[model samples]
Target chain A: MMEKVAQMIAVTGAQAVAHAMRQIEPDVVAAYPITPQTPIVEYFAKFVADGVVKTEMIPVESEHSAMSAVVGAAAAGARAMTATSANGLALMHEIVYIAASTRLPVVMPVVNRALSGPINIHCDHSDTMAERDSGWIQFYVEDAQEAYDLTILSVRLAEHEHVRLPVMVNQDGFIISHGVEPVSFLPDDVVKKFVGELKPIYPLLDTEHPVTYGPLDLYDYYFEHKRQQIEAMKNVEKVFPEVAQEFFKISGRKYSFVEPYKLDDAEHVMVALGSTNGTVKYTVDKMREEGCKVGLLKIWMFRPFPKDEIQRYLTGRKSVVVLDRSASFGAEAPLYEAVKSSLYESASRPLLSSFIYGLGGRGIAIEDVEEAFEKSISGELVTDYEYYLGLRE
Target chain B: MAEQKGWKDIPIGGTIVEAGSAREYKTGDWRVLRPVYDRSKCIDCMMCWFYCPDLAIIQEDAVMKGIDYYYCKGCGICASVCPKSAIEMKPETDFAEEG
Candidate 1:
């Protein structure tokens, strides 16, 4: 297939994702507007109103209903999608699990935000982190360009024959969602050919060849059904790269489960996901200028947690600092725990410490990252307890 | 009993590929009370046929025949809706060996 000249446009992360959705032209979009994520569906809604895309847009009452509607549409063999933020994701919690277990390939872009307690609308990983075990293929993007690219890539990944599972493409709430950046697009026709049409195995709408979905599965068969889902997730780990390779051919960007930056022969490394990876990269570059042996590992795909690849990159490093945006209450932070587990089988592993930072959108400046890096290199970072970054004493 | 399928043999996502496969599961075994029809007292109102939730009422050319005990779960909707009391709900124990 011949590649088309990429269209360069300056847009917020939410609008970039919306542009991707418009190009894909999903059959149905059932969404309820929430902060940060609202602009995505809002822009798509405008596309429907202006006759740019012939999508059946359903303005739902709640996030719960929004996901439920998407599930229904997907079951009927339609390519369906939705978007939400922190509290909205929490509201859709139940159906979110259903969408995956039922094996419907629903693509949803989640604008990462802090979960509510005192109720602040800001950037954090609390929302998606809470859903880490919900059986969805999750991708965390660093900028608007990646967000746009991953949103398009997620559709193909979710609908792959061997991996018919839902996908969540995450971007930082207001930091990336509302922040304007230059994003390149792969012309509408190229994207449409790349995504292709969803060919559902047994759609509920195929009346002539009817199939029963969401049946009351009992003890006799429930375990077996869950086993099938496990196998499907395993397929995602394999199929993701193939789909991404095809995407790379059409668009010049490549994606993978973990993206390592300047880790060759580095002694100290910082591990993180989402937009914080961008900051960490800047910090690594600044530290390297002063001859500091520092690098960064950015986990793009969190679920089906890329253990072997992560272990490979961090194996010989002297020390590794994991920055988690969400706290796991009494336990080690989510990403920190995963990194710890991944390294358990390695013959030689880095001395790892967990740092909880930027909860409720507390900004982590370059100085803050430099401070963490300096402490890790000096072996002063605590391994037993998590250090809090940007927390007031 | 049909051979119980292993996880690999079953369809992905627990989807039942065979449409209307519920017909294969004989639910009449669940009936604790059976509805007995008395043809002589029948008013032919077809109320019993219309009210049978299980579609257990056998009918041909709009004419009521005996109930199909194969699927009747004995909800007794047929007996309750009989305008002339043509159908009676009888305890399963009363007809000891009958299916």
Candidate 2:
């Protein structure tokens, strides 16, 4: 068990993440500044300039090159990381798959924001939900404390032997990104020891035994290479909880694939991700005090789905309402799709429905969640699914 | 047919087995025309050796040892760069006929 005492500091989520980066002292952090995500790199830049962290900060022209540079750096056996939001994440979409397909465990913290057409960006899940299939392990944080902790934890999880996949530690844009909260920070020595020296599996820079990455893998082996990535994701199912348990030994804060709150006898359970869970938890507690059997399951590890665990939680619930911040055009929303698919194979299932809420940084109050839970249990909301919450229609 | 390797047989990240494995994947089959060398008229300028795009022209001790047809794509750069006209582009059918 790690015995180092943590320093309690009040800082924004971006600063918390930047502090974690300073502690990890990654070999390279190539990033381009965009709103919300800008502060993460900005704070780290101050660290680099002040000699607080010796990280080689590469200020690239675009998020594409930031991801590309980090991919190259990680390929050459350096622990690399970066930060981005909505359009920036979209810009890096191509190389994002390359980073995962190449199996370089470079950590990136995505400050979740709305993908723009009207150009409104306060906080939403549209950016990350769009890249749901992009082969990165996503850990959605509900607060600045999680943003700080997961930023450091992502390094350890990404570099694990069983799961050599890139990890995206996600926080809400402007909301958690700019909101200051009291976060207990682990010591630099503890972090350094935890995220030990990276032993790259097949480093391209090894002169004695050279290797290639991102080759033109045609049909002859393209399917097989993809299968390897799928297997790596599957390995996360087993590896993440183990790592989180070990991390808890030192930090005293346990994390899991999915965080359950009062699901033991919940008749109405709301499933969501990111900072919305904070509001849902508060609402659930308030409802429980008034004798409502409502609960919540805030998913942290989004990729690898945690299908069995999710099915285990919502299987026999009386009413299940999934909240997705981003909508899927003509289809079910991303989170709804994932949760529905997980329960599709289960023997017992809940009366399920989905709500599209918090798009373009729309405000979600305790009343909004309460209304959804009430409608879910009462079966009063018709159309059964995709109930638009807080919409003007 | 998928390649014979099981999931474990494949390397983690599409890593090639040996250094310069591209040499093993013969591109000669892609050739429509082939470069034929005349050692008699050769002044050994090494231009053909230097100009061969596929590194097809083999050089031993600074002397051109003829083209390695196995990996030659027959781009005709070797024939074009030869000042002595010692290298000529001929139909690949000639080699097929000879075989």
Candidate 3:
């Protein structure tokens, strides 16, 4: 496959995602608008109206209906996609599990934002983190470029033969979704060939070969069916990097389940996900100049939790701190629990601690990360399970 | 009859093998009372056939034939919908003597 020279263009994460959707030109897009993610579907809707793509753009009444429509279309053997944010994603909660359990590979882009109570619209991982166990293959992107690339790759990964499960590409709400950055766009023909044609395993619409979905399963088979989903997610961990390698050939960029930065020979490490990695990189570099052995581990895919890769990176480190953007209330935050469990049996495990930061889009400065790393390395700090990094008093 | 499958052998996404497969699983065991039809008084109005929750009423070419007891949960919908009072609900134990 002869590749076209990728063109660099300035666009926000949402716009870049829409451009990828336009290029892929799926058969159906059923989505409702929400903060930060609204522009993604809005731009794709424009592409549909302008006849640039032949996708059937459904302006659904709600996020629940949007996911329901996508599930129906995908089961009928059509390539389908959607987009949503915090509250909208919460509304689609029930059907999200249906999409996974039914094994429909519907691709969606989720703009990460704080879940509402006092109603603040800003960047946080609360929404996607809350849905960790819903059984979807999840990917968190650091910036607009990664957001665009991963959005295109998710379609292929979701439709892969081994992993016929729904996929969500996540980017932080305003930090990445609304921020404009220079993104390298692949040619339409290249993306078309890369995604190829979706081959649905058992299409309900094929009258000649009919199949039923979402049937009642009592104790006789419910557990067995859930085991199938577990097997599918296991396939995701093996299949993700392979798809990324194929993507790396077309474009010059490579991606993995996790990205480790300056971990070698570092005594202290901070693990986080999404757009925070961009800031963490600068903080790590500055701390390195001062002779502090500090590093950062940026997690790209969260759902299958990538335990093996995490152990490989943090093996020799002295102290590790996990930064979570969402609170788990009565328990330690989600990422902290995952990291702790992964290292629980390792021979040379680091002293682990959890720090909850950026709730409701609270600012996390480099000093906060540096302070956490400093306290973690000092050995005088009490082994408190979890700390709120930037909370006032 | 549809070939029976173990829980593991069933299709991945709860797909039933054939259309209208409720016949394969005899649900009559769930019944405490069974519907008895007095066919001589039956008008063949087909109301019971249409309103049966179990679709247990056997009809051929719009003519009421009989009830398929295999799937009839004895819900008594046929007795309730029969305008002629031709269908009656009887205790399931009473049918043991006839069997």
Q: Residue-wise lDDT of candidate 1 within A1-393, one digit each (tens)?
A: 114567788899999999999999999999999997989988999999999899999998999999999999999999999999999999999999999989999999999999998898998899998898888999999999999999999999999999899999999998999999988888888899999989998899998888888998887789998998889889987999999999999998999999999999689999999999999999999999999999999999999899988888999889999999999988999999999999999999788999889999999999999999999888887765589998989
DockQ, per-model, please?
0.63, 0.48, 0.37
> What residue runs in model 3 are displaced by over 4 Å at the alpha carbon?
A1-4, B1-8, B33-69, B76-99
- The candidate maximizing DockQ is 1
Give the poorly placed runs of model 1, Cα more than 4 Å off.
Answer: A1-4, B26-99
Residue A143 shift from truth in candidate 2, angstroms: 0.8
Compare candidates 2 and 3 on DockQ and give the better one.
Answer: 2
DockQ, prediction 3: 0.37
What TM-score fits each model? 0.87, 0.88, 0.89
lDDT of 3: 0.88
lDDT of 3 by residue, A1-393 (tens): 113657888899999999999988999999999998989988988899988899998899999999999999998999999999999999999999999888899989999989998797998888998788998999998999999999899998999988888999999998888899999999888899999999988888888887778888776578888888888888988899899999999887999999989988888889998888988999999989998888999999998889998899988788888989998889878888999889887889888888889998888898888888889778744554788888999
lDDT of 2 by residue, B1-99 (tens): 222576667887776746777756767878999888999999889998888778888888889788887888889998897999998999988778665
**lDDT of candidate 2 over A118-200, digit per residue (tens):** 89777888898777788899989999999988988888889999889999999999889999899999987888898889999
RMSD of 1: 4.1
